[model samples]
Target: MLIKMNNIHKSFGTNSVLKGVNIEIQDGEVHALMGENGAGKSTLMNILTGLHKRNDGTILIDGKETYFKDPKEAEKYGITFIHQELNIWPEMTVLENLFIGKEITSSFGILNTRKMKALAREQFDKLSVNIPLDQEAGRCSVGQQQMIEIAKALMTDAKVIIMDEPTAALTEREIQKLFLVIDSLKKQGVSIVYISHRMEEIFEICDRITVMRDGITVDTKNIPETNFDDVVKKMVGRALTDRFPARNPNPRETVLKVRNLTQKGVFHDVNFSVKSGEIVGVSGLMGAGRTEIMRTLFGMDSIDSGDIFINGEKRTIKNPHEAIKLGIGFITEDRKDEGLILDFSLRQNIALPSLKSFSPKGYMNRKDEQDFVDMLIKRLTIKTQSSETNAKDLSGGNQQKVVIAKWIGISPKVLILDEPTRGVDVGAKREIYQLMNELTDRGVAIIMVSSELPEILGMSDRILVVHEGTISGELPKNEATQEKIMTLATGGQ
Candidate 1:
């Protein structure tokens, strides 16, 4: 075995995160670490990378006991971590970001810029990455930034690499490129600890799978020994009966109508209507302008030419605040950058959208705010110490739940959700689906933007396929299929 962790234990105050987790990895295998969000997968990897200290455990590398006191020491031991959020400085050049702390220095104490650029180019060439090394890191696309993150890991001569939700921000093509790099690394006897929530990726790329639930090791199996159903069982500690709830077959009257919505150089000639008690899913390939459409509809982006009709009456929403006032809410795609306020507590985050209602006569009502937030916290099943717990302290799924709760407090008639379950676990996905069921049951129209075809097929009453900034086709739930959606999304016309 190349790495072995036994009886790994960790705790955060009264919360026991990882209890007796164990794992053994061979030298050249893509081992998947699977679990529900808040199930301690990140904590286990954090311990391995020296981000967190295990209260009690043993880690063996090459049959010898070892320890990493910090991330630098972990890197020195040929173990590199590629965080889901790339740690590279956005303002720095690609070459500078790659060689960050380990910049080569000449004998005269001058920085060896030429040597560093040469080394960085050699590594990018190995990965088949095509981007200018002199370009600023922030200017690169999300896919390119991920590639640079991997290249940065390669610079350390990494024998073992930990990838956390690597495909979360990548397009379909970029994801394929990443898998090819993983294959190359495996052929070179490099072990990878792949942490992700995507089911298809787990089955296609992993050789072995380890499941965790509520901070304990559930089961580990070879790819051939278990299937998706069994793995999901281990992940959530229960069988997942269905992917989506039974939605209303006949929707009510149209609640939102867009006519000739145009955002120059982005999307144009868009026309659609979302009906009450229905889920209208927007499906498309990456950069097909699905998110852009939603942003424009929510007034985040100014539309060049369009008319929005709410309840058969036209309204010009100059900003999101106006849209919210007019009974429209949008859950943005990028949670980290645009969603909840991370530094604030759950009470503050949930009360954000409905602050005016919770207060009256220009006076803030503390009790009403806390009570309202507490009610949503319980209703949403958000796991937290209390309503006062900081939003950042929660897991990915819970943080997303916070965003939903905030919007729900507003009671919007039309709700736009962009990639609602992007980085969440299977169990959390089910919870969100149920929440959607409740919302639709209450006559709220939902516009869901998703890249996952299965989700669109499973949850949508009607599917809108967008291709290159235009609506290519629309299909009813019974007629929509993976093949048809893909054809339209790829501009089949």
Candidate 2:
């Protein structure tokens, strides 16, 4: 299968998303779509998959012009889009989620349970996924959920598969398995549109790359012809000298400390401390209780037994409200649900935590709120038409920035960041790292839980590797290596 999108244009009211974009995808090859968040890469793919209609463009499929009426119609024509956002029905079973719309039935219209299981098993086997078919989808870890989505796409036997940030939640092992599957699919003549901000993954697996910036295609080159620096320059329209900013750690007294924190069956005996003006990076495989620990600290989950201390004084955090009042801020991993309310405006989301401060004398101070929002928008370099724009209107990277800004409004003494740059681009990532440096410079202690090793090694003052439910090893910045981190993460001494 081959696809060509020429002069694509898309607009939502007055906001233009994609303008005169072009791309060509060849058969049996993995084509990378590289861009900063909101650069219209996903928009262009949405147009091809019929989720969004191109206001002006031409789509040619195998030398014939084709426009699918909807995603279902496009799936019928062998095009499948595995979106960045996992669309799992949390309450549904894994088997049910796999065959939701395309359930197999007998001649009498009775559901064929046995046949569906057989088909689902086959797809899961191909992807090496071990999730239970009868288990609730929400019960699975984020990495497991990601695999389910991949298996769902594979079940379609799609001629063209569009993967948008597919490996964002996957572990190193799962990512290697996925890469092997991509190689197999290429051999089987399946073309993949690989959309990701991870430069290393793109260079390793893709055959060609298309760079998009500001709603237009900047350039397309074969993987061998383009370097990482070149692709990044095209995507951001600027040169990024460093992926992470340099930090001068000035450690002070401990701001937050946890001793023998037990979440029972989830995590146990987790002991750690974050000094003022330090970044403690937590490294672990997905589902290794990293997020669980952070949630407990933020009062999202109750610990079986633990001692949480703030500045040498013991504190009890029963809920998020209490945690906030204690000067602790949490930036959750799932930004869409926990971080920001999509329908809320940028100002509303940014002002949510600081509303009490703005409401002096029991009255809403509109001027103070507006000024605060404007400062964050400029400080974080958030790209938007205006502060009144809905949170959902911004790109993934900008939404993350809004989440950080929301936490920053409170001037926290300790901030817990879980996957701070999970889906962010290189340029935005640098900005975030710089911001972390700035925050720490202000004597804020930061505990960052991350899956990416390079980020941990580059940005952290110290690294703590989580294995199973315990902290297995801790390494200082000058002594840490990827090999050491991976070994510790897998329960090695």
Q: Highest lDDT among the candidates is held by which one?
A: 2
* Model 1 clash number: 0
> Judged by lDDT against the true structure, how good is candidate 2?
0.92
In candidate 2 the C-alpha lDDT for residue 287 amounts to: 77
Question: How do the residues 80-144 of candidate 2 rate in per-residue lDDT, one tens digit apiece?
Answer: 99988788999999999999999999999999999999999988887778888999998887778
Worst 10 residues of 2 by lDDT: 238-247
User: How do the residues 1-493 of candidate 1 rate in per-residue lDDT, one tens digit apiece?
Assistant: 3999999999999988898999888899999999988889888988988999999989999989888899999998888888765576779998888888898999998999888888988888776777798999876655578788988997887899999888776656567878998998999999999998899999999999999988889999999899989999889878999867677655899999999999998999999999999999998876678888888878888999989999999999889999999999999866666787889998888998899996688999888888888889888788888888888888877888899899989999999998888778987888888989889989999999887788899999999999999999999999999899988988895
* Alpha-carbon runs more than 4 Å astray in model 1: 86-99, 102-148, 154-156
- Candidate 2 residue 314 C-alpha distance from true site, Å: 1.3
Question: Number of the top candidate by TM-score?
Answer: 2
